[model samples]
Target: MDVTSQLEWHPLLRDPTGRRTVKPRTRGQTMVIDKGLGLHAFEDLLQTSAPYIDLLKIGFGTTPLYPTGLLKRKIELARQHQIAIMPGGTFLEVAVSRHTVPEYFDMIGLLGFTAIEVSDGTIEMERTVRNELIRLSREAGLTVYTEYGKKLWGSTIDAEELVETVLLDVQHGAALVTIEARESGAGVGIFDANGECRDEELLDIVGKLPEPDLLLWEAPQKQQQVHLLKTLGSGVNLGNISPNDIFSLESLRRGLRSDTFGLELSP
Candidate 1:
C-alpha cells in the first residue's frame, strides 16, 4: 500500500497544497544537502524522511572523506528509497580545476551515484565545457542537474544571463538547473547579504525564465523556503535543504505550518 494511503486525516485537515506527486515527481521536488552524518543517523533520516526526499546531496568535498563502504552504502540507501544521490558541485569544480574530469566521472560511476550536479559557482566554465559535462553525465546514465549563479558574497542574479544558461542547459539534457543560494542562503544568487530575498531580482529572474519549473531555488533557510514557496507557489523545486528541515519544509509547502496557513483557505 502507498504509505500515504494509510493516513486518516479528516478532509478539512488535509494538506492545504492538495496532493503532492509522490516519488519520481518532476516538480515540487526537494533536494537535501547532507553535510555529514554517521551511518546510523543516515539510516534514521532515510527511514523518517524518504518519502519526502527527491534527492540527497553529499555536500561538497565530503564525498571522498567518507569511508568507501559507508559512502557506497549511503548511495545504496538513497537508491532504495527512490531518491537520487550525487556529490556536491564543488567537488566537480575541483575536478575541473585539477583537469581530472574523467577521473571524477569514473569515481561517480564507481560510487553508484544516480545524479550529477554540474555547477560553475567557484570556477569559470565555458558554455561548451558546460554542455559537454551535461552530455557526459547523461551518457553515463546519470540525471544531470546543472546550477546557475555565482557563490561570491553579494552575488546576485542576472536575469538575462540566467535565461540563456537555463535554455542551453536543459537543451543539452540537464534535468534541472539550481539557482545558487549556497547552504547559508545569504549574500548569494537571489538573496541579499542579510539572507533576505531581493524580491525585485527574484521577480526579474522568474519573469524572464522560459520554463520556471526547471529552476530549483537553493533555499536552505526556513524563511527563504517560505519566501520562495509563497512567491513561486508550492510547486517550486527547492534545493540545498538541510536534512532536518525536510518535514518542516513539507509542512510549509502543505500550508500545515503557520507561515503558510493562508494556503489552507485558498480555493
Candidate 2:
C-alpha cells in the first residue's frame, strides 16, 4: 500500500464494520439506475460513488433518448471507473418486439456498453426468444442479466414459477437474475404497496438459490434498502437504486450507518 496515494479529505467518518471485496467484486453488487442524469451529474456520480457502484443501468428505454455522443461518453466514463453500464431491459425488449435485435446490438456494441439486460416484465416473451436474446447478447460480448416477475405493483412472487424461472435463466447464461420490483420498488414482486419486503417470499428464494449472489433484488427506495440490507446481510446484490442514493446505500450496507449497525452477514 502506498501512503502517498492518499489525496483529499472529506470529513471525519465511521469506517464500515467489515471489509468489502473491492472492484471486480463478485458479491455485494450495487446497480445504480440512471433515469436522465445530465452530463455534469453523471460525471459527479462516477467521481463520487464509482467505488460503491458495480453496474449502471440507464433506466427505462432512456438510453436512445440521450444524444449519441453524450451517451457514448457516459458509457466510456463508467468503463474507465470499472463499472459495467447498460440500458434497461425494457429497452432491449422494445428492440426485440420490433424485430430489431440485431440493429439494437449493433447500436449498443458500437456505443461501447459493457452489458445487456434481458427481461420480459412488460412484454410476454417465449422461452426460446429469451434464451436466444441471452445467447445473442453474450455472443456479442455483452454480459446478460435476466429479470423475472411482472411489472404490476401488487403482483406477489409465484414461488414455484419464480424459482424455476431463475434456475432456467442461469442455465441459459444470465450472469445475474433480477427480481422485478419495478422502479418504485412498491406493490410489485417481493414488495408490498408501501415498499415493505415480503419476508416469506424473500426467505424462500434466498434460502434456496444455488448462488444467492447471482440474484439482484430491485430495491429503489431508502426504507426498502435498509430493510433488505438488514434482512439479507451485506453480500446481497441490489439493483434499481437511484443515482443520488449510491453513497447512502453503501453506508447502510457497510454498517457505517445507524440502521444496520451490529448486523451479521452471511458467508
Candidate 3:
C-alpha cells in the first residue's frame, strides 16, 4: 500500500520537532533490534513503520539460527524498504573469536546483508583487529557500525577510552559508533542495574565525543529513550529500540506525547 507515502498526520498539528527527514535520514535515526520475528511480523513492521527505522539488527548471534531462506528474505525485505540490515555485533564477535572472518564476510554477503556491526562487547579485540574488521566490512560493500563498551553486568563506558574508540572507528569508515547497552538495557553501558541512566557518566562520555552525533545510544527502555531525547535533542540517533515502540518513540521525538509535549516549542 506504499506505507511511507500514505502515512501522514494532519498539517495543522505538524510535528513540533519539524518534518522528519524521510528514508536515508542522517539524524533522528532509529535502529530497532529484531530478536526473532516471523516473516509476517517482519513485513507488518516494515509496512507500518519502515520510514521511522534507519537500521534493523537481527539480534545477537541469532542470524545463524534462522533458516537460510528466511534470513535471506529478511535481509532482502529490509533493503527493499531502504533500511540497512545486519546481524548483531555479537555474531561478528563470534567470528573474531573463532578466526573465521573470511567465512563471516562470505556468509553476510551470501545472505545479502547491507551492513555489518563491529563490536567488542563480549570478547577482547585488539585495536588493529578492530580497524581491519571495519575496513574489511566496508570493502565488502557493507555499511559498518561499531559498538563500544562491554556486555558484562554493570559495564560502564570509560570516557577517555570511548573518545579514542569513536575517533578511531570513524577514521576507519564506520557509519556510526554504538554505545553498548545490551538488550536488557540494564547494568550496562550508560544505564545502571535498574535500567536507570547514569547521568554523570552519560554527560562525561558525551563531553568527550568529538562528534557526538556519530554515536548511537542503545536505549531500549521508554524512560531512557525519553531522557536521551530530552538531553540529546530530538535528532539524536538511537539504537536497540524494540519493534513495538517505533511509533511510540516517533511520537516522543515529534513532541506528540505528554512526556515530550511542547518539547520543541520555543516558549
Candidate 4:
C-alpha cells in the first residue's frame, strides 16, 4: 500500500503550494544523506517520508561497515518505497584510489543498490576517468548522479567549468550533476562561509546552463533550502539533506513552512 494514501487531508491543506509534484517526480527531488541510521530508524524513515525522498545515499565510506544482513535490508526497504539507494561518492572515490572499481560495482550490485554517485570531491580525477565511470555505471544498469566541486572548505563554483562538467556528464548518461555543498552547506560551491547563498555566482551558473533542472543543489540547511526554493522556484532538485530534516524540508518546498509560506501563491 502507498504510505501517503493514509493521509486524509484535503489537497489544499496537505499541499498549500498546490504545485508540489508527486513521487517519481522529475523535479523537486530530495536526496537524503544517511550517515548511519540503525535498521529500525531507517525503515521508519522510509515508512514516513518515502514519498518525499527520491534518493538515499549511504553517506561516505560507511557502506561496508554495516553488517551484511542489515545493509541488505535497508536497501530492500528503500527499493520497496521506490527510492533510489546508492553508496556515497566518497566510497567510490576510495574504490578508485584502491583500483577496486570492479569490486565496488560487484558489491553494490549484490547488495541491490539502484543508483551510483560519481564524484571527485576529495581527489583528482581526469575527465576521461570520470566519463568512463559514468559509462560503466550506466552499462551496469544503475542510475548515475555525477557531482561537481571540491569538498574543501571555502571552495566556490567556476561557472565556465561547471557548464562544461554538466554538459559532458549528461552526454555520458549521468541523470544529474550535483553541485557539492557537503553536509554542512557552508563555504562550498555557491554558498558563502556563513552558509548564505552567493546569489550572483548562483545566477551566473543558472543563466549559463541550458537545462538547470539537470543540476541538483545540495542544501542541507533550512535557510539554504528556503533561499534556493524561493529563488529557483519549488521545482529545483536538492541533495545532501539530513534524515532529521526530511519532513521539514518537504514542508518548506510545499509552502507549509513560514520561510516559504504561500510561495506559489505569490505574484
Per-candidate TM equals 0.94, 0.93, 0.94, 0.96
In model 1, what are the clashing residue pairs, if there are any? none
Q: Per-residue lDDT for 1-267 in model 4, tens only? A: 998888699898889989887889898899999999999999889889999999999998999999999999999999999999999999999999999999999999999999999999999999999999999999889999999999999888899999999999999999999999999999999999999999999999999999999999999998999999999988999999999999999998888988988887222
Q: Write the per-residue lDDT of candidate 1 for residues 1-267, one digit (tens) a residue.
A: 699888788754667566666778987899999999999999999999999999989998889999999999999999999999999999999999999999999999999999999999999999989989998999999999999989999888889899999999999998899999999999998888889999998888888876789989999999998888888888889999988999999888788899988663112
Residue pairs clashing in model 3 are none
Better of 1 and 4 by lDDT: 4
In terms of lDDT, model 1 sits at 0.90
Q: Is candidate 2 or candidate 4 better by lDDT?
A: 4
A best-first ranking of the candidates according to their lDDT comes to: 4, 3, 1, 2
TM-score of 4: 0.96
TM-score of 3: 0.94
Candidate 1 or 4, higher TM-score?
4
| Residue 162 in model 4: lDDT | 98
Scored by CA lDDT, what does every candidate get?
A: 0.90, 0.87, 0.91, 0.94
Q: Give Cα distance to truth, residue 90, candidate 3, Å.
A: 0.6
Which portions of model 1 show Cα errors greater than 4 Å? 1-7, 11-14, 264-267
Whose TM-score is greatest here? 4
Off-target runs (Cα >4 Å) in candidate 3 are 1-8, 12-14, 265-267
Ranked by lDDT, the better of candidates 3 and 4 is 4
